[model samples]
Target: MTAPEPGTDGQSVRPRMAQHYSVAPEPDAPEGYVAPGMPGAPVAGYDPAPDPAEPSAGRRRRRRRRRTGLAVAVSATAMLVGALAYGAALSRVQSSIGWLAIALAAAVAWPLGRIGGQNRTLPPLGALLSATGLLLGQLLGQTLRLHRLEGTPYGELLGDALRIWRADRHPVDLAFYGIALIGGFLLTRRTASTD
Candidate 1:
């Protein structure tokens, strides 16, 4: 085959080689071939030459995938550990406190799921605020339910606080706080991908 001559337009009209579309070189070993990494041995697809950039690109992709996997593994491990610790603590609590704690945990997880869905980053302050708000919401919800069931006036106070909270941007505040967790996860993933 004749090599195409370079032209002013920077296009070569040479026929394409089948190797261009093949993942591996022909099975027949070429004589005197030596792979860079395999030194002195006939490497599977050793050509006397190869693009230096190809190896680097592969390495980069592998590194990025490694980091992502590591992050996911660590996140899962942390969740499991925290759940176990909380369960142990919960078992030792009084029934009332246990139920309250379970309610609060459920509330906290809801916002956490939202944050994950949004894929946002959360700073430490935001984490603290959201956790506190979730716990408070659960506590208030339980208190209101209990008082209302007993047909007492205390339920009215909860209703008022809820109204004031709703009117005074409590929902917005909680949303802002929850956003942090999403942000944290997103930022971490972004960094991992780039690695």
Candidate 2:
């Protein structure tokens, strides 16, 4: 420690000791030297400065959109798989297995609804998706049946399938389709509630 020096006014002044003590660093401090509690100072191996290589806002938004697009694509693929299974099952059996379509719609809608609920902004896309799946499954089953019975060509099955379904459509089938649409919409929608 240095001795106090006499001042011109008869008072003693303490020697400057900031360099030897734990204090805020000067603006011109050497690289890698940081004083405690200073902004941008590293603490516990953490750095506060933003990295130059970090993505910009637009890049981040694009990345998020890509991820969301990928998720929707995967969901659509799953819906197609479910529709194929429903059609195959119905074609092989003599009894009506239409109820399975309803179940599949609900199952697909549930996840979409849950995901939409979390966002609080996107409307549950599940209803439209599930309805499309139901229609596709029914069309597929009708096509398979027509091919088996009337020897419809593989290439023309889709058009013939649509024609047969239109000719043989029943009130009960419409009711089932309406029920599935309503159910899918309900499953995907989330209502806000007060605590």
lDDT per model vs. reference: 0.44, 0.67
Candidate 1 C-alpha lDDT tens digits along 168-194? 454554553355344433333333221
Which regions of candidate 1 deviate over 4 angstroms?
Answer: 1-55, 95-195
lDDT of each residue in 63-176, candidate 2, tens digit only:
655644554565577678888987877677766666675686666665554433333322245566777787888888887877788886867889878887788777777777
Model 1's alpha-carbon lDDT is 0.44
Top candidate, metric TM-score: 2
TM-score (all chains, Cα) for each model? 0.27, 0.57
User: Any runs in candidate 2 off by more than 4 Å, and if so which?
Assistant: 1-67, 114-124, 190-195
- Span of 10 residues, lowest total lDDT, candidate 1: 117-126
Work out candidate 1's RMSD over C-alphas: 16.9
Q: Record all residue pairs in model 2 with backbone atoms less than 3 Å apart, i.e. clashing.
A: none
Q: lDDT score, residue 126, model 1?
A: 29
